[model samples]
Target chain A: MAQEKTYIEDIERTLYDIKNVDKSKYKSQSGLTEDIIRDISARKNDPEWMLEFRLKSLEVYNQLSLPNWGPDLSELNMDEIVTYVQPDAKMTGSWDEVPEDIKDTFDRLGIPEAEQTSLAGVGAQYDSEVVYHSIQEDLVKQGVIYTDMETALHEHEEIVRDHFMKLVPPKDHKFAALHGAVWSGGSFVYVPEGVHVEIPLQSYFRLNAAGAGQFEHTLIIVEKNASLHFIEGCSAPKYNVTNLHAGCVELFVNDGARLRYSTIENWSRNMMNLNTKRAVVGKDGVIEWVSGSFGSHVSMLYPCSVLKGENAKCEFTGVTFASKGQNLDTGASVIHCAPHTSANISTRTISKAGGKATYRSAVKVTKNAPYAKCSVNCESLMLDDISRSDTLPTMDIEGDEADIGHEATIGRISDEAIFYLMSRGISEDEARSMIVRGFVEPIAKELPLEYAVEMNNLVNIELEGTMG
Target chain B: MNKEIFSEIPMRTWNWLGVNEATVDKDLLVESQKLDIDIEADHHEKMVVEYRKESYGIVNISIGENASLKLTQLQLMPEERNHANEVNIVLEKKARLQLVAVETGAKSFASKVNIILKGDKSQADVSVLYFGDGDRSLDMNYVLDFQGRKTVGNLEVYGGLMGESQKIFRGTLDFKQGSKQAKGYEKENVVVLSKGVRNRSVPIMLSGEDDVVGNHAVSSGKINEDKLHYLMSRGLSPAEARKLVLEAAFNPVLELIEDEVLRQEIDSYIKERLENE
Candidate 1:
């Protein structure tokens, strides 16, 4: 029998690669400058304190330098990136009020249908501003605050002011300062004390401008004895010029509360996704993070948790699929600052067609954190010899009572497993696909059924010919 | 005193985490001794080397085709002093190397071991055991660079940290693009004995070849209370039981030492230190 070579096509990306005509109400000039910051502030009608805060963040951004590690980011030029692009539509509560072009984009991405079927509330952003937002009447009557960040600043100024940029300050890193300086639109959710939002609230961000940047600020606070789940979805159309996304997420879980944040980011190949997300848990509180990375040219994202009170807990589960021309560097970090705190992290990464994937993480146990426990496990599968995968994890323990363990492995699909499946009347390509799907089953099951289905579809698109 | 960075991680990360590298302060004018060894084709040899209150600045070893060598090094430093050591090894086709290092005492110690498998079917195995007490600080970097096809590498390190001591351990397993079918594994275990001890571990695996397999694991914690209670039930004092448990942890590498006399000396050294603690 003559052997035949099997070829798997790259991602189709037709659903996410649909570009719209440029009809932005305004576009800030390319590059970072005091003038541009002032212009953005003036256009947004920001409060005086916010303008000052932006200026200070810009100062920090100027003082900071690029990260000395991770993927090569020399190709990113801020001079050619427009810091802000206001969509042609205004923030509205009715989906019919949104511009046809903007609404059509969200329709293609299935945001409205998702909101109508399962989501409790949904906020949709086109380019640099929220075009539409809606919440169920019961949720609103129950005093659950779900709206755009801009509205939160206006109606709930006190709450927004207290927590804005508090967990992730501008000084956290270079990109964080950039996000603080130029952040435009994102979601703000608050679950009141003892209230439980059974259904998940979601926000979808679509960047339709070329050579533009999206700097959204997402803030969620779950009060004492309350529980909530928030999901974030974002993507952009591919362009020749490099697009940037430097968003920031701050989550606060008060005492006896729980919060689960899930995200699936599928940006275009010409994007640089450098986002910062952090959470602080109080006594007996819990925070769960579910993340999936499937796109972007270069990405550096690590969601962090600070266990600040006794008996606090954190759980992180994520998966990354990096194909040709993509370099996704992602992981999780946890700081145990109180006694009896614990954290568990598990992740899977897949690299093929010359792509690169790296898992970087840190776990720190302070002297006060006696009896703290942390465990991290990460696995990587390289589908081709031309690809690269790395695992770098650090653990710093200061007290004898703390227990920490980390395990990592990098390997390719075993020929024996493929052969075993093929002998059972399965094609080689289908067998390979089954193995890859099984590899990510742990993380996929953690997501909602729809998102899990979407992730499976993405995996199939990434391995077209070889996938069932 | 001059200061320099030592035991750098294979891939740098966030500098704020302070795991990328370690800083060592020492006098550059101090001279170090050099040891060189070469094994010819098809030759097998074994040797024991000791460094007592002294430094081995540079050591070079090369193994020819079909050759195998087993080398054991013992480091004993009972006083406050600065020490630094560097070892580099190269292996050709069908070559094998076994290394065992036991370090007991030093006020400030820094060591780096680099091994390169330059030919096909080469293999290397390394085992290390160390103890940190008082104000002592230990920094160690170990690397296995796989450059040939079907190479194998394994590294295991075990240590205890006590008092105000601080230790940083960085172990890397790098499989190059052409190192198809290569297999590498590394693991480190640390036991914190006191409240003031600080332990940092960085286990890295970098692979560019899909056909290769690499793995690393790190575990750090306090002494097992269940085991301690079981030993105490066997008619032993608390301190004695603690020392016995640690000894059991170090026994795997200790049993590999062929020299009974050297092993006895190491045992006595560890016993005295544990008693004082």
Candidate 2:
């Protein structure tokens, strides 16, 4: 008897790799300078305070130094990156009004179809400006304001002023300062008090120009006794030159409110992703984060949550895959500042073909946070010997009344499990794929059905040709 | 009059995990020893080493092929002085080594241990127990390098902290290339008993061989509340319940000590420290 031959196929990313020609009506000159900042502000017609705010942020960006930890970002030169690029169209409420080229890009990515069937509202940003925006009439009648950040800045000035860049100040980090200095277009969602948005709102960002940077600032505020869910999707076409993403997300959950923020980022291989996201929860409020990172040449992202009120809670569920020619350093952070606060962090990572994946986290329980509890669990799988996976977790508890636990494990797939499956009339390659699917089942279950299927397909593509 | 200056400089300088370097007094008196011998089949060796003064010492030992050695080390310097120690060990083909270390008293203590498996089928096991209280600080760095085929190494550390004490632990397992069929495992558990006490632990595994396996796990937190409540309900006071918890945590490392007298001394020292707290 002879054994059957098997072949593994690589994952096809045709849907996301389709690039649109550069059709920008305006693009800022390459490099960071006072002139470029002034030009961006002037073009956007910023308010007096906003102009000053951008200048202050640029000052901070110049004064602050790059981080001494995590993956090195020396290859990312600001001198070669164009800070902002405006497409050849203005904002529109109807999809038919959008330019054909811009509409084709979103259509290929299935944004309009998703909005029509699932999302409550959709804001599509092409390059550095929102090209199209729409919301369900019922949601708008219920006083739920969902629009582009630029419009909200002028219409709802007071609310946007109070919450803009407040949670994650420019001085938080060097990239944060850079984001504040050059941020262009993102989504602004405000759920009214006691209103429940049954469907999730989504914002899609498409970086079309090469050698350019995308700096979008997303702000979401759920008022007292209200609940909302927001999803973010971002991707770019592969290019020889470097592209940068330095976005910021600020979420505010009022008393007894809840917010679930989910993201699926699939940047091109020539991208350097340095994003920041933070949230502050009020009394008895809850915040949940679901994230998936599948692209980028180098990435350093850590979303944080501050449990500021009594009985506040947070839960973070994430998964990251670092394939060939990629290095991703991502995780979560939680600060328990009040009594009875609790946090749970669970993450999984996969590395193969010389890629490196690191999970770094910090959980701090202050002295005043009596009876605070935290638990962190991280698991990593290395498909080949040449790959690397690391877990670095820190717990700083100031009192003896707190309870904290951390557990991490790193290894490869077991041969016995593969053999067991193979004996049941399954091919060896299929068995390996099944095992990998099982490994990420916990994270896939947390996603929506369509997204879960997409994640599984990604796993199948990554596992192809991995077995000898 | 002439003035003499003394500086606390760590012999090794590098970042551990994410923390900075830990400094130690460099002016202490030095003592060193080296041991190399071969043992025949069905033979064994045992030795006990102790440090009692403000001093620095280095001890190197190599076990012969098919031989075994059981070593015990104790650190009991004065409460006001700082001390540093280093140990290196090698195991030959078919050789085995077992080590137990007990750390009790020192204002500031630093120690480094390195073990190498140089021959085929070598094995090593290590156990450590320590207590930190008052203003005392303890730092430990342990590395296990596997260079032989089919080698195995295992390490476990247990300790407790109270008062304003601090401790940092760095453990590494390195499997050299060509050392096929090798395995390494390490675990560390620490219990915090008071506020303002800091505990930092970093466990690393560096593997260069495809057929080798390495793993490490660490956990630091307060004692279990349900266990404490159960003990208190069974006719024990709060202090007694705390003592029982600490005892249970350190019992795994203590039971491995071969010397009864030394174990008794360590137990009494821990009991006195807990009583004062």
Candidate 3:
């Protein structure tokens, strides 16, 4: 079964994996404790309740059991996991103030340049701190609150306290408890009632520290009749030692509001990224999720939605890339709690190498939701025979009037299409890449131009690995 | 070899497949008998499933002198499935058997399914729907043999899988030789509402004899994004819209189950599950 190895699997990208986990100042001691939570809180200058909340969450984190199904998390030892790592820098709204090393990292990622022209706002988090954040002054003057989560917690304490971790609380799952206990830098945005943000606001997270975890928290609230589009980007320099990203993103779309949240995570393979995100849509409100999971050794991310009011709806568009050494179990969940509520989830996955990409999804129509309807269509692309893709979907229809349809197909790029292209003189690799880009292009096309370009570039990079 | 040397084998021999002895449960098998479409004494030249009308004891075997039997109901069933009170019959030429099946259930237990189309020129039109909280595996396999020309068979199954129970559905339309001018169609749809549940749909088609037509198709997933976006953009959250689409998705399968009493029973079971879920 042995053949030639791929380029990305070789040592070419070792620079990204190079790591030095300091044993001194920032290393977390063994096990989770109130003192550890307190020390981290003191370091971050958390208010009284945030500190108390972290300790309360630590209590819950220690008590809850690991998930019974999905990919195994037995390898993730809390004692071995350093939940927090403060990069060597302070928060800076200006690019000049960010430490040279951190700035160079983001520069290589091209975040500052992407923010300069395309995005309306951008927040950059390095390791456990949001080292840089900025937004259009027009947006600032318009009362659209977009800032680093830490500053938001202190300046707009009311908003932070009211909606923090509400959609997915500490007890929702084991990692969520861990996130609530020791969460750090992320983004916070509030789109006011009847307002519309013309451009997408984006946040990029970089896990620059080795043997440490990045626990950022993102909180977004779109008030009644408001509309907003937010994008989140996550990537990390590679580290031989395993790092962890247990970030949490909670969104609340109030009555008549519209919110679309998009995220692209390109972490390194030595990372166990167990992120949790969820949203709640109010009466006549809507929420959309566009997710891309390209890297991470093992990732369990399923963004959920709850239609809590009559006529509420949700749409989840996601694409996952499980290349070598990645077990990405990603999908979505929805609960129709009110009559006539509805949801639709369309997802695509690409599995290469020996990676495993499982589309695990569920939609439940409560008996009280008399007229609920849901339709799911997911497709998977297995680049090679060794890679695996499994589609496990479930629907609980308590309402006779409900409609549910699910269809998924798993195959490689059609040989016919590839041959047809190659016959015209296009190289096989480029032809395959073109087909794959097309396969994932639908989800990419929905993102802002810069993000779409980034997604295509990532897909191209993965395609290069396929050939090498 | 196209030889018919094995007709003497006891009907009981088929039971050797189970862990239990072939004859230990003898009550379900009545007096050994022979049935024939072309007079068993003459048709016995080929490996045959012989039957006698009087063999069912005083059970009264009047399938109507005019009753016509369909021939597609004599094939193999997959392994490891649930069943209760099933009957097998080798039909005489031109006997009829009307078919109706309804599936419904409570938490963890899915609705029961029934299949009975074991005759020549007999039509088995069935519609089954399952709505419940728990996992119920449905493995329904049936075949019909055609002794006369222009025999037809049809089967439709619709069900919902909730909670953690896994559902694997297998439906096949097999057409045999000399059953020329015979045709069959089968379709199965399953809804998986929870990550804990498992759903598998295998729609199979095999034609051993020519001059017969058969086809099968399956569609499974969650909801559609266009539908979700349309609803969400209209001020409805994605979850509410999903419920709407799910109801619309399974409506066709539910509408085919006739029998108001049985339909309502299945409908209520489905509704009850939704409420509890």
Candidate 4:
């Protein structure tokens, strides 16, 4: 039996969809090797220690093995993945100075308009290289340091050297080791004490090179009593071949500081977005993460926070929508390593059209972390019998003095609710979409305005033909 | 995925079987026509499953018209792992069944139940007990479905988890689209052992094309500290006074067990679990 399939015809932001092959273009050899590592070090004009670090990372990457849990990644062979694709242009401050083709691609995606309206600063990376970077002048005068990682190393060497790859070391995992070996062009932000950057600093990653992998590294350090909000967005044009995104982000929140990181990812269907993000918060610090996942054929992501200091806090709010042909396994992790630490996490997910969505969470309260208070709540909606949703939440409580609670629910819409809507003359499709939109209302309300609109639109687009 | 979301998962891989036409295997996608499943439970003097009142993510079990069942269980508390349990039952027109559960607790323990009824006529009653520390939890749920014009059913639970513990209860009554003119009822109660224990009770009802009636109630908490002080005023040691209260609270559930040998085994387990310093 042949049945018609439904897909989003135009994924809204497809302007960055151009593809080309330049054999003579600046590039490195295939696969991960010493030669490839040396080539990357040369391209970045690295110092002596960085070069040695790259080689050491390559050794670790070789010894480590790929993770077997979550989505099966056996079909994604490393040999077929291009580690780096150095764009033709160096890092520039203005969009006009960039090559016309790349500039036009972003221009059509409304990047320039968004930067001008509300963003305090912006950094744009295109396939292993940052093509455009800039920040507001007033903040720079106020001692806020925001610039490319490589440039930061050369200009503010002491600060960059102090925090680079510290929270998450190369030995953390296999992909991390690989990221250390061939990482390129990401942002470095340092917020001064007691200062609050009102407008969010934004970074956008656009993958244009075919069969190439994007391994950008982001490092953010918020000093004592400072506050900052950073926004990140990623997208790629659909391709027949798989493109890999294995970026890394590490945040350090000092005493009494607060940092909120939000992300809206709309990768193309061929993308394998397996990125790592972790934060270490000092005494009395707070870290909040708001995440939305809407694309990719398969994804395995669980952002974690290590509450290291007394009275430190963490909150994670996330939403994931897995449509047909997509298997998205995403959640959050928190570890209370110190006494009086607390963490709260709430996640919502939707599975439709035979797609699979799984929410996995881990909360660990060490023995020394007495009086720790934590709660984890997860909810999933299985649209139909054919669609599947699963929730797996694990709790490890070593201290008897703490209060830890875990709750989860998995169910479908009540037939009576649908029947009532149908009796009111609403079409089945409209009624169903309305219910789902409301189902995800709490999560969408937490997102930025434009992103919230786009999320609802994606929901409508995904529900097309799923109604009976 | 977020700008930061990747945990170090132990690298393991599996050979996935994809679903596609021509090569699609139907054997991998069939629900067994013969639906026969059995579950056996064992506890060191006690086993407990509790739910908070009006809580979500509840596991529900319902009995329909003319349905018959045979159940046997044992409960004991070995002073260490105490469970305070509570459960609710509902019946309607000719829904006939029998359920037996065993319970034991160490310190704090409490139980409560609420039952409702519907259909032409029906009946049900359940019993359970607790022996533990300052442990309290609720086991509350209800099955309220109408029997086809004239049917009946019964439900009973006995068990407890205690030791500064908490329990919950859920009672549900569901009347499907059909089954006009039916009625039934059910009820449950529990005893508390120790302090610092908590329990919640929940009652549920669902009606479609219905002409039925049902009702239930649940209550749980710890032994009043003032009451313990009163026991001290009576010249009994704190441990002996605590044991007296536990024995009185568990008598209802203990009296219902038909086998004396089984009742003695549960009594010994309760004595062991409730042995506090």
lDDT string for model 2 (A193-253, tens) is 9999999999999998999999999999999989998989999998999999999999999
Q: Which is the leading candidate under lDDT?
A: 1
TM-score of candidate 3's A chain against the true A chain: 0.91
Error of 1 at A113 (Å): 0.2
**How much does candidate 2 score in TM-score?**
0.90
User: Could you give candidate 1's per-residue lDDT for residues B1-277 as a string of tens digits?
Assistant: 5877756878998887787876666563167778898999999989776777675367799999999999897777655776777889999998999999887767888888999988899999999998998889888889999999999999999998888898888899999998989999999989889999989898989989888889999999999999999999999999999999999999978998999999999988888888998
TM-scores for chain B, listed for all candidates: 0.96, 0.90, 0.58, 0.52
Worst 10 residues of 4 chain A by lDDT: A1-10
lDDT of 4: 0.64
- State the C-alpha lDDT per candidate: 0.90, 0.83, 0.65, 0.64
lDDT of 4 by residue, A77-155 (tens): 7777788887887789998898877777677766788889978998988788888998999899878888888898788
lDDT of 4 by residue, B195-233 (tens): 244322222323332233333323222344566788989
Tens-place lDDT per residue, model 1, A102-126, is 8888999899999989999999999
Candidate 4 regions exceeding 4 Å error are A1-24, A420-430, A461-467, B1-277
Q: What part of the reference interface contacts, as a 0 to 1 fraction, does candidate 4 reproduce?
A: 0.03
Q: Candidate 4, after superposition: displacement of residue A186 in Å? A: 1.4
Tens-place lDDT per residue, model 3, A1-468, is: 332222222113443443334322365664677888989999889999999899989889889888756777777777777777777677888999987767777787778888877789889988788889889999888899998999999999988998898778898888899999999999999988899998889898888666778899999999999999998988776767778889999999999999999887777888898998888999999998988888789998889899988889999999987777888888988888888888989889877667788777767666667667777777776655466665555454553446656555554556678779989999867787788778888899877776686676655533343232
TM-score of every model versus the real structure: 0.97, 0.90, 0.67, 0.70
lDDT of 3: 0.65
> For model 1, what is the error of residue B21's alpha carbon versus the real structure, in angstroms, after optimal superposition?
1.6
Comparing 1 and 3 by lDDT, which wins?
A: 1
Report the lDDT tens digits of candidate 2 across residue range B13-73. 1122233354564454344443444545445788788887736767788888888888888
